[model samples]
Target: MLGTDDELSYWVLVLTGPQRGKVWLVTAVGAYPYPYPQPEAHGFAEWVQHWKTHDGWWS
Candidate 1:
């Protein structure tokens, strides 16, 4: 969940397997920016790139 002076936002993830299922969640809380829009747009590309770049590092 994200909270700001003006608005709030939240993110949730759920994963399921053949037998066992996994669930993950993340929350962000910060002050709203000068613009009235949401922050998800600004960092989305970077986030996806990073995820793809480092997602397999453990392997």
Candidate 2:
């Protein structure tokens, strides 16, 4: 099982410049946000939910 600290830590990366519209989910270890909904959300549930509620994703 992942520790509380590990489970709670995450990041979102939005690309700029030529890449433009790419957004990513980054973590202390690492992550790759998928092209589809609810992909690989296991440890990032809290953060993903927060992002969704706060005008992110489909909001």
How big is the positional error of residue 3 in model 1, measured in Å on the Cα after superposition? 18
In the range 1-59, model 1's lDDT, one tens digit per residue, is 22122233432222334312211223265433211243322233433454468742112
Off by over 4 Å in 1: 1-42, 55-59
Expressed as tens digits, the lDDT of each residue in 1-59 for candidate 2 is 12232465444434455423444444565655432255543234544555567744422
Worst 10 residues of 2 by lDDT: 1-10
User: Mind sharing the TM-score for model 2?
Assistant: 0.29
How many angstroms is residue 45 displaced in model 2 relative to the true structure, after the best TM-score fit? Answer: 19
TM-score of each: 0.24, 0.29
Candidate 1, residue 11: lDDT: 29
Residue pairs in candidate 1 whose N, alpha carbon or C atoms collide under 3 angstroms: 1-27
